[model samples]
Target: MNTTTLASTTRLNPVSRPLPVLLAMEDDAEDVGRLSPDDRLTCHVHGRWIHQCVASPLHVNPITRHRWCRSCATALTVSVDELSGAVTMSCPRCGHGASAASARLIVACRASLVAARRGSGARAA
Candidate 1:
């Protein structure tokens, strides 16, 4: 990865969740804002579903350009800027960058994002 891409890629902690689940969980209904108690529960359930979906391995083939995680069945699109050493993954819902090894860290960040959204949403609602 180029320095710029590397810089853009968020560094994850040593232990963290997977990215998609984190993202989905972060944006759960309650976090999005103005949800009722039932909506909050529904959102939590949805997030749990997403978490299960992200807890598996992804498959990739260099020759076929076929890459996807078995759990979520989401397509994997990667962008590498040769000049800048930036490697980004356009996740199903959002785009974030980091070295492959940083995947765990990215996931952790997403969890935090979910917490942030929930906090803000609670205040807004």
Candidate 2:
């Protein structure tokens, strides 16, 4: 019987090992704005997209016209239905509409969602 250590096994099949691919930082300004809405690659505000900046969920306040959920008094999560292209913001706890300022945000979110679905199909091909 023979026993091989985990480290030894890794060394024997280096080519079979999966390599971690890091996303390169985008530098071209022209390409940055060209990103589709659903493209999480770059943020509209920041020149480069940082996960923390773009990934954080949004909230909305009807009275204040700000990002806040007054019914639940907490931040709201934005949900996108990829199939129907419907973007909605609601109180996570109470299921109430949080803000009237959602019109612009909703439009942007819908466009992004649709773009993402289309992009995925292209990549698969």
Candidate 3:
């Protein structure tokens, strides 16, 4: 038989593989505290991660009324430098500095981003 035919036959008649019990259980387990600051956890006034959500496009501080990039009028994109553990948000259009709110959010999410990167490393599964 040709290589293609053999491959198709193997796919059609799939081999039965044993399911991993531990993995299945772990999948069912609730992921508490898995959400980072950037996640869609809703705030009463701001809605879901309003300060960080890309869909929002503009973040207005309720208290200060400060906008991320006044000149560009565009929302800042969050970037995490995993190597340096430095988090920064900058305007996608003009590369403007972050506003007061954006700066605070960057500082808050830096540790979380670093932790996430470290946890993403290959582990014995």
Candidate 4:
């Protein structure tokens, strides 16, 4: 696994609740004290929802081509439709920037968006 892809940028501390639980319990932008709003199901940084804020420049990765169009040298644009649960990342110049990392990010965004809208996030036992 590439550590860079999933690395989290957040303040650290010991927290008892697992990730799913925290994601479910905390509302949008709620810090939950220890964890950043940027959970695994949310984002890699920016401490924001996957669907809400993926346009950050930090999301671009040239090596992994996550949100970068190497040939065009452009950061791919993110499109997410909460109502339809659709998510996509593509380069505006050429419309071709699919990548493994971006695919994973898309899946995460779709799940997070669906769960947030439906209030179906996993609950702790």
What C-alpha lDDT do the candidate models reach, one value each?
Answer: 0.35, 0.42, 0.40, 0.61
RMSD of each: 15.1, 17.2, 17.7, 8.4
Ordered list by TM-score, greatest first: 4, 2, 3, 1
Q: Write the per-residue lDDT of candidate 2 for residues 1-125, one digit (tens) a residue.
A: 23432223323443221111101212232244432233223344543222223225433344564445675566656665556766666657777644555544554455444434444555566
Off by over 4 Å in 3: 1-67, 114-125
Off by over 4 Å in 1: 1-71, 94-125
**Global Cα lDDT for candidate 3:** 0.40
Candidate 1, residue 109: the lDDT equals: 32
Predicted candidate 4 versus true structure: per-residue lDDT over 2-112, tens digit per residue: 232221322132234434453444443343343332334555355456677776787778887878888898899998887788898999999997777788777667756
Per-prediction TM-score to the true structure, in the order listed: 0.22, 0.42, 0.38, 0.61
- The candidate scoring highest on TM-score is 4
Judging by lDDT, tell me the better candidate of 1 and 3: 3
lDDT: the better of candidates 3 and 4: 4
lDDT of 3 by residue, 1-125 (tens): 12222112222454321123212222233133323322222222332222224234344443442336777765556665657766666767988845666655554445334333333332322
Which ranges in model 4 have alpha carbons more than 4 Å from their true place? 1-39, 120-125
lDDT of 1 by residue, 2-69 (tens): 22221122222222334444345435533444322211211233343222222223423223333343
